[model samples]
Target: MRPFRATVFAAVVLAAVSVSVPVAAAAPGSGSSLPGAGPAVHPDNAALDCPDLLVVAVSGATDSTADRNPIEEETRQLWSNWVGNITVPVGEAKSRYPGSVGWMYVPYPATYGLGLFQDVPTYQDSVAAGVASTNRILDEQKTRCGDRTRFALVGYSVGGEVVERVARELGHRPADAHVGPDDVAGVVLIGDPYRPAGVDSLGAPGPSGGGFMSSEPADYGDLTDRIQHACRPYDIACDAPEEIAVLELALGVLGQMRFTLANPLQTIADAERVVSTMAARAAAHIVSGDDWWQSDESLLDVLRVVADKTRPVPDANLGPDRLREILDWAVGPGLPVVQEKLRAEGAGFVEDNSGVVELVLKPYIFLAFIQHIAYWNNNPHDPWYWESEKIVDWIGALAQEERERDSVGN
Candidate 1:
């Protein structure tokens, strides 16, 4: 029952003052298990019946009290709502193709809070848990399908981080383990934190130059060719720089002064507000057609959380104009410097490449107003959901092709 001390990414400006996040009372059945050695045991391979392709879907962060199962199920449902309509179910996939596509849910500790600070250990635990679940399922699928099953990974936000970790682990997999990139058909990542400047991308480029954890140069092993990253233009979660070192010192000072309150209740309340604002922005940016952000139950829940945690603090009297004035001061002089440095580094000045602009603007625009959450959702002629649907279609195609190959070999 020893606690794992995780250092938050200070550059992200969301690190908790306490620093040491306890892992007690987490989800059941997760501990020191090796990858592919948990929840995927299928001893009777002969009796097992499965689809031709297994789509392992992973979800992003949720509330600390949230269960992984429901999040996994929600991801599966997202696929069903978007992709399942295009093709037949696993039961009917065998007729049109060699076999059908099915979902393999990978459960992980999707602990919530400010990701850079409070959830580092949770992120690590999630990576281990997800990799373990995925590898186990792949092994079982191989055994049951007699080396015929193929894999397609689907991940969103932090879930995408877990997917990348799994892919990296597979690169160094032991010889005894019978799964590798060859068994993996395709990869679809939405707002992945590991997305860098130069990777196989599916849709628009990310805003920040690299992923949240990809400050250093790292590879996704053999899965690079099969992977497709989709990062929205304004989604700072994926596009913001891996390390905003230039801004961290000031941010750290402000975080200590503002976020770290003397009263425990106030601290908790402010943290919840940050998390809520983040969730609202994410939901606002990702939804489509209808103004789901206005009616989103999750957003409503976040509002309730914020309300319940309400308390007075410093800057309580600061109006919007005053807040804007402060922001202008913070980002005004530095914008040119940051932009110039990026240009010198050969970074483009376009919206997608200007991490500094997004880092400053997203909070004011996307995070502040629910009405402003219409970047990807409001447009009809240039629909944003297509970015996600395209990946789903690609996965379906990969599965079909692999199934066809297997059927031909049979």
Candidate 2:
């Protein structure tokens, strides 16, 4: 094997081992926060305390201290420095618009755990918390401010995922929701991991490749046109290539689990889904005689037979009484077969697609960290594009428009 392949395999092994271990739990009510959030433009007690526009900002994962317990960190109000990306624009908007605009900063766990090493909440937990907190605040504000106020959402990285999820829910206009599609003025996403390919950025054209988790189509429904996003070139979070799908999916699963230990059923469900999908794809490649196979289909067929034999009865055939039996089969006998198939087929696929992996995948994986974090600053390569400045300008324009509407109404 080549040096780069060896390195990739080693990293995958490390990640696999890391996610197997469990981390500590978060403190109660740690998911919700209003701390350091600026006051409403109108007084709390006013009968119709509605700002013409309200911007809700959600920050990405924060720095974790090894010395402190996870619980302590959860309770603290420490936000990620990336929040400056959101705050700067919001501050400028507020300064320009004054009483016409209001700001709410959501504080969440924002901790990305790395198993036994990093003592923090898992990526899933952190994002889940952010979505919950953001929605709660929106609901409260919508009820308090009445129908006159308009809402805009801003988020960076993981927070972008949260904002997108909330926006999707609102766009669908769920009956339980306090705010609907008409209530949202705009959504701004910076370095979102779920950004779709070919979508134009706030200022310029975005990357051709979609995000790591972009396999699932993002359905924002009515709010689709109102959304804007920015993903710098070579950023793996948003620009992952189709050639490295398996590797990207594996990394995504690890990030979702992290070290905080996800629920057993949820973890199994996720793992099963990933494994089955990979196996199905490999089977398709074999049938199509794709260059990656490099071997006879008989071997893969045998593996598939074994998997079929081990798989539990179809869910449609099972009753509530047999749910436990299916879960046991999924966790025990069924999962390992597909896992083994992935292990056997993944290396050969990579080896066959080494050219793309060398030129695109390697650079993307190596530079992802720097590219992901550098969105707040101007890209040295593309001097004309500065994500933060664009956001500030866009938000300020929104505020100005609201102010103008208010003036016209008066």
Candidate 3:
């Protein structure tokens, strides 16, 4: 609405906030990274939480249990995989942690697959809501765990975007954060596309790298193609391959910038500063119902905003059956073995301390290596085995780490 606001004083804080902690890019910070990122991350030798606690938040993807039917077994498998499933590849981190850790999956009402992700009036506004929600969750959890518990935030897909928002919001002085380092250890994001709000160019490309199919990988071209074509009326991004001969599209706003809309600062210090400042602003906005620049000026407005963006997905290409198959394959069979492996990672963290975290992602785009394949790739019996499941497993693993961490401490 307002002219993109390059004039905001927030940029002044941006430069000073980007410092690094002793933690490597992959590790927790030794020094504070984001303002509220806690004491440090990648505290290799520090006494880490034996059983780390995790709060796994999923955007409400399904209104009721309807959509979940396909992934019900998988959800159970995921549950077993973390709490106990042996068939999963990643071991259960909770088992190794004892009573010290656990993971609680927050299931919101799903608005189709996009859920509330699409509901944020704008990604920035959604970004604001996510920041508020994270801090609120931390506050509640801190009260629940008292001073003893150390924690982190793990988000998948839209949830990952929430994590990024929290990171950016706390980009100032995390030390002064409402949610102390002792409560929330760090934040972990998975399957995040990090696209900017309302930027049309950011949509996925279609196959043959030309039409609506340019951004999508060629390997699953057929399935995605059907989805694209089916979605033609609803989504601006969804177009048929045949339509490619007519027009060309540009990349989304996020496509121009490599950094996430959630956190723009590259270094740890900057991230902390921005987030802390956001925390301060968010606190004020919460208290006074102000700050419409990014926030919606009121809590109800934010909720309403989140509601507006979500809509139904028309394409059912990889619906219940396919999703179920994916879940079964990833979480079935060696449930005990899988749990064991995840537990092993917890064993790696034998002590307890605190910190922040940030991952400097590679420039690689999602579905980057997809090759041109026939329609058969969509078939469950095909060999490709639907690598999307593997990526999904990665999310499970990331969340599992937090679960295991929480388990060990108690």
Candidate 4:
């Protein structure tokens, strides 16, 4: 296989093309913040069909249901939370709007947990798919609803990454971009992996102080005002510093090498183990409320930290039954070993390097315990809970603003 560093640029570029969007680090137009110098369009929006108020919501990675896609699930939830679950029936919402409040779900890979080494390309493809699908939805919706439609966009996790790209695409209107600034009411991002450190977010702050898995600079262009990012604490996918990720990846490579030297056959056999561990770790950041573990040198020392950090959760107001139920959901089926280690060893080890051990072990702990996949159910007290609500509230507010504007215009 080619060296990992050599593959990085090519992979990123290919991923960019796959999503039909530019992934450049420089400001648009040679350091010019001006929109005129931004990257041109990838997905054509010429055929978009918009309504008076259109809301598009995309879900996090692997956030799909058997019948509904992630975007569809999120839209359904948003509508349910705001309208459907309320006294008003859902169908009544459509009638109340009268083609006013339209929503579209974008289709993408939404790959299941872990194996970043192999799955990154799939993510790129999913990004492309998401862009195309969203554009198509907009086109179809607008065609059916009319050109006067306004749009509100929301995304979570990798879905947040996709929405960021779409926002950038909208910012730099193609020569044929029929959708203008006026067409967008607002954009909401929840647990966004691409959320920059300094960017204004409504809810929890990003954990890493940097965007997830991306070292590139993000230019939201004109959409800056309307964009709001919600990243819970320690959600490295959204806030983990780029340096930490790079360090972890480097550690993982070393761990792979160490394992390969021990037994090449064993290393081959352990591919799934290593990849899944890494993926679990990455996913854990999105759900974990705290870092819970850190290292100065000794493995046992870090384990102590892990124990201390995790001890508080069970000791909280949570009762034994609720805790058991939560644990059942987290460690169900193929994940008992994760809980066993935390309860028994306090931490697990894969190599001499603490970081490597972390890569292999952290995921099991976080994935088994933390609530990463479900944001809609986040408790009101949790930092992410308010953030999630903030987005929904903003969408409703934006919709109301659009309606009032329409009323005044009429």
Q: What is the C-alpha RMSD of each candidate to the true structure, in Å?
A: 17.2, 10.9, 26.8, 19.7
**What lDDT is obtained when candidate 4 is compared to the true structure?**
0.46
Model 1 misplaced stretches (Cα beyond 4 Å) = 1-48, 63-98, 113-121, 174-176, 198-200, 203-208, 246-358, 361-385
The superposed Cα distance between candidate 1 and the true structure at residue 76, in angstroms, equals 12
lDDT of each: 0.47, 0.58, 0.31, 0.46
Put the candidates in lDDT order, highest first.
Answer: 2, 1, 4, 3
lDDT of 3 by residue, 1-410 (tens): 01111222433342233211011011111221112223322122111232244433433122112112111223321111121121121223234434333333332222211111122122333333444545554555555556555554555434444554454444433565555443454444333333221223212332221222122222311122111110111122222222221121112111111232333343244335444543443333333321232331333222222222221222324446755754574487645544664565343332210100100132112212111100111123445533223322433454465555545754
Q: What is the C-alpha local distance difference test score of candidate 2?
A: 0.58
Q: By lDDT, is 1 or 4 better?
A: 1
Instruction: Tell me the tens digit of each residue's lDDT in model 1 across 7-97.
Output: 2342123223222322222433444222232343322111134556777766555422223332122222111222222222322333444
The TM-score measured for candidate 4 stands at 0.50
Q: Quote each prediction's TM-score.
A: 0.53, 0.64, 0.32, 0.50
Minimum summed lDDT over a 10-residue window in model 1 is located at 369-378
Instruction: Point to the candidate with the largest lDDT.
Output: 2
Q: If both were scored by lDDT, which would come out higher, candidate 2 or candidate 3?
A: 2
Superposed model 3: Cα runs more than 4 Å off: 1-51, 60-91, 107-130, 181-183, 195-410
Residue 328 miss distance in model 1 (angstroms): 47
What's model 2's lDDT at 265? 54
TM-score: which is higher, 1 or 3?
A: 1
Question: What's the C-alpha lDDT at position 209 in model 1?
Answer: 51
Of the two candidates 3 and 4, the one with more favorable lDDT, higher being better, is 4
The CA lDDT at 279 in model 3 is 41
* Error of model 2, residue 172, in angstroms: 0.6
